[model samples]
Target chain A: MTLAASPHHILTVTVENKPGVLSRVAGLFSRRAFNIVSLAVSPTDDERFSRMTIVVDAESAPLEQVVKQLNKLIPVIKITEVPPAEGVERELMLVIVKAAAETRGQVTELTAIFEAKIVDVGYDAMTIMVVGEPEKLDAFSDLVKPFGIVELQRTGRIALPKLARESTRLRSVKTARA
Target chain B: MKLTGAQALIKSLEMEQVEVMFGLPGGAILPVYDPLIDSSIRHILVRHEQGAGHMASGYAHATGRPGVAMVTSGPAATNIVTPLCDAYMDSIPVVVITGQVAYSVIGTDAFQEADTVGITMPVTKHNWLISDAQDIPRVVREAFHVATTGRPGPVLIDLPKDVANAPMEWYWPEKVDMPGYKPNVKGHPRQIKDAAKLINEARRPVIYAGGGIMLANASNELRALAELTGLPAVTTLMGRGALPDEHPLCLGMPGMHGNFTAVTAMQKADLLITLGARFDDRVTGKVSTFAPDAKVIHVDIDPAELGKVRLADVPIVGDLRTVIDEMIKALKSERSKQDPPDLAPWLATIHDWQERYPLKYRQEEGGPLKPQFVIESLRDNTPDDCILVSGVGQHQMWASQLWKFKLPNTWVNSGGLGTMGYAVPAAVGAKVGRPDRMVWAIDGDGCFQMTAQELVTAASERIPVKIAILNNAYLGMVRQWQELFYEERYSEVYLSPDLPDYVKWAEAMGCVGMRVDTADDVVATIEKANEIDDRPVVIDFRTDWREKVYPMVAAGSSNDDIILGPEFGEGGR
Candidate 1:
């Protein structure tokens, strides 16, 4: 996690990306004294709703206040709080590791323990894939640094509801209504 | 019939007179690529997506037309963000198009999809995510009009994959009606009259111009007002070519790295007529002391700019052309009210200051390659109509100093945000815009290295933009600061690491590359770089790393407090 890690919380937002939308959202969080740890945003399939998944790094009171301010923005549609334990939180990471033939087996051994797959094996290097909660990925990555980590690229954090099934039903109902 | 969102985007782009677009293709936008085969718009394949945006910005800056860029979602779109921010900050008109995943899986963690709009909110002037086919044409038109008008900036329209395939009748509208997009075009008559009154009444007056002159294409009008009112002029860094540098009344640029005469003139002025300029911090030294005694008449197109910093006695919100024209008429009406004009005292003061603080470099006469001479030589050799582009920091300031730019839109740079990698692609875009004239990109070693990869685009496009790299291996600006403030601790400024040899680097990127290790070789190498005949050339001058630019006024210090004559310039004091 980055230095400014927010506690586990979920927020869904819609924004019209004119100048200062990020400033407005970040301002709202900072004004309410909330720190956002994890964030993900993507244009909805139709390209209208730019969905945002934000994890506030503050206690319950300030995080809720931040959410309320986010809701005030014209582009922000809804921000729902999600329980960290109940929500499905996942982050995907691709690690390019520097390993020699002598150290290949050790790297492979560590990869197996994390349930990671060896995506590619070059002459002097290998790439491993890890997909899980950010904490788990962080732990797995930390274990392999001794083996010489070449580079790391993260796809940030993307999430779905633990009750994702219920959200589908709600989406279907909304689609039917539309 | 059904059409994908990407197809609708392509169709919308075609309707907006966008004939060329620059970008790197990615998976999320393949749907649009599939449909692009049938369209007339030509996409110049760039090695990187960021180059696409800067190229478009260059095109816009050069031609006084809107430039277009396309990229897929996620990192591809993220790459465009830097250039979009560059365009937004510098006020270059560019439209960026990105592809998005289907609406069905927006928050479900779709592949190769990221909310580009959300990431770009703070960077762009305006952006839209078009989910509905019905809104595509209207929004696309709106984006083009908005990006190109008023204070020009980069606008984005993210189209989903499915929407590009969804079929609809394609119709192009003559104009768009955006309720939220009305730009002020006519100046307030009273404000114009007041501005004219001030100019006519003042003993000492100066016209401060900016990039807004290019946005409004108000160069001719600016010249008219300056000539008619006989007000000696000074330009913001971005407004280098707004008026010819050779004009006797032109005081050159003001602020840090600004001429001593110009800064002195600005300090002595009683009335400051700022047209198409926002008294930026770089131009205005300490906000409190910046034109402290002067009554400011600010004329700008953007309403938000008014009183955002310094208060305006006459705040005229309108088009630059219309406002300048109106001011001219009003000044003529109040001709009899003209004050007894003799700036002999002011000019004498400026002359004394220039003599006291001459912009003379103190480096060894026969030392390693110096950027000042390279920039001066480039200005002399480059055609009268040739466009000049520059990266951020000291090199950019040097280019502004040495180059005698004659027209607006000929000097393209990122002044406000000071983005380092802006010059190369902007020069490439400038070449595309004006295929006939020569284009030169002056950049520091650090800034050139940031976007040097764009050499591939110039090679691929047969757009030869001469790149003169002021190579002082170290991050000159940062190193200068460490020397000044950090007790010369020499933190992370040194790059002893074996980096790419620029000579071979340019050849690898399919362009001509040369190096000048000595001052004697600079003139010849630059001449050779210019003679490449439709192929981009890079001349890396292995300049001295431990030097600093002179005539420095600390970031927030008063204009009169500038320190001159090299040995760390303003930093030494």
Candidate 2:
């Protein structure tokens, strides 16, 4: 399933802190059309290198291009293209919706299906907290859309895709080989 | 004698330049959040804890960096499952740091207690539960190493509440000691020789480059290989721009949305060298009939990728760049020969296919806009080095179909994990990375609404990202399926009622926005959007609501089944 320019993908890169290293790496990402959702460069295990994670919602081809470009940067040690299904992913969302007496109960029920917790509640509206995958969150958000969702805030996506079982075994094998 | 767990985690992540995180605060993790207050790391507070995971995933994907998300124990930790599963299957590198109900309450089902490690075991690249304060530094360090190396996937470190808050003497490791994490960079010398032999012996050879080429940072190697072997190269979507488009030896994208010439060439090739690319369905059409007569040489970093679908004649395991270098050194250029003896007949057949089924679209008789027109407009307006992000569905297919993508990473879309609502925020991410290049979010109406809220992030960040919404008023891809296979029973596929007024919504989000109801307005609106200030821009192009994407091959069908637009004779009969 090819995702067109969708907001589902995210890229995170960590690199070395050196003069023009940021420019060199950033040059590669921008050169390849890889977008940076949230870019932060700071400290790492080694004061010499920094880690940067960006979110670009592209298909594998272009994202790979960006990664290759990043790898070319002398400061960039490694780059990865983290796909949604290959890892554990999450996004943060903040929704403010109407909470009239008539709609409050149904809203609560809807939020329950989405497993949204209420962070802040007001007579006129409520700020709900629901964190799940995008689909469930989306369904819940849509459910409340009819009830008048006034505002929404979603953090970009974060993810962790599990290793294949074979690699797990390989980890053992490498130790044996070593 | 003590450092905050958050500080330790920050210090650990700081070792990785931990700049951004997406998460929500809860009882068990309050202490961890407390230290975040003193740190410079910016945390985007999401409405739901799950969004934190996706936000991190999105951040990672857009920037080619690992994304991190933090959440409290039990349900908050569990809430991140869907994206975890999504990331697990799609191979996104995300680090999910979940706060547990303290080391003491781990198994008691205490308030907010859940086995996050057990729950995320199958979804993360690796999962570590640290109950000891002293382990946070090492665990976080290991997480970054595992998450972004080799085939790059997600990794997690679930910290207990007591552990996150526990005082630790911070000790940063000089190098991440990942005993289980060794990725192969150099290919086997013998295998490289065999690959050269395959290249030398092949009469009609085609090189298929995958995402691994990008992963190995081997585009130049790939190009060199293609040139050294005189083989025309076909790139998987993930391998897009493995070779510049203008290169004579380059065959454009190959897969479901690929060019007729590309698909036809792959079908007729006698020798197919597949590098870093998996035999994804979109690229193979139907497994049984795809390149039936070709001898496949598969090269990839991961050994499991060698024969998962289309078995390789020669399987080489190593980083693509190193392998290509080895092959270049070993392979003899003098041995390069012209395509097979009967190449003329095959080339003629492909040329015929190109003439028969050219990719095309007609504005619904009297309709105002065409989807292709919008994509082409952006392709023209965007700087040569600009990035174009796409949403899933017909628009993504259309962009792949119409966009003249000469370079890799310039086009961002979800491929293996066909996630919608990916383009907008991804474009925002891209703009954040490279503020100089123009970024466009090409999405269908059905997908735009999915992650539309991220527009606020783009607006707030002052990232000059532009969104081009192909307002087709339906989940165009599924609707096309319903139209073709289900006798046009549109079902719930129609999105007219649910679609938002994108122009107004963009304005509400504080973006410079407009709508394009006709072909003539496309260029102007895109041009106007480009001129906007340090804010995002939106253009909702009101295209014909119901139209079909052409050149579709039915599921489980062969390459012979491609339905070329009426113009093409046959997609290579």
* Top candidate, metric lDDT: 1
Model 1 chain A poorest ten-residue lDDT run: A1-10
Candidates in order, TM-scores: namely 0.76, 0.72
- Native-to-model Cα distance after best TM-score fit, residue B263 in candidate 1, in Å: 1.7
Candidate 1, residue B108: the lDDT equals 71
iRMSD, all candidates: 8.7, 13.7
Badly placed stretches (over 4 Å) of model 1 are A1-178, B1-4, B337-340, B362-365, B496-498, B567-573
Per-residue lDDT for B362 in model 2?
Answer: 68
Q: C-alpha displacement of B235 in model 1, angstroms?
A: 1.0
Chain B TM, per prediction = 0.95, 0.92
Residues B43-138, model 2: lDDT tens digits:
766555655666676566556778888888889988887667666655667888887888887677799888777667656666787868897888
**Tens digits of lDDT, candidate 1, B1-573:** 345556677777887878888887777688888778889998788878888988898898889899999889888998888888888778888899898887666767799888787778667767787767767888898888888776778888888777766666655667887534566699989888888888877877878888788788888888888888567888878888889988866778888888877887788789888887888888888989887779999988876577767888988889998889888999988886665467667656666766665566644568755668777777877789989998887788888877898878888888888888889888988888888888988888788778888888789778888888888878888888788768899988775312768889989988888878777777777778777876888887787776577677877789878776555344434
For all candidates in order, the CA lDDT equals: 0.79, 0.74
Give the docking tier of candidate 2: incorrect
**Predicted complexes: DockQ each:** 0.02, 0.01
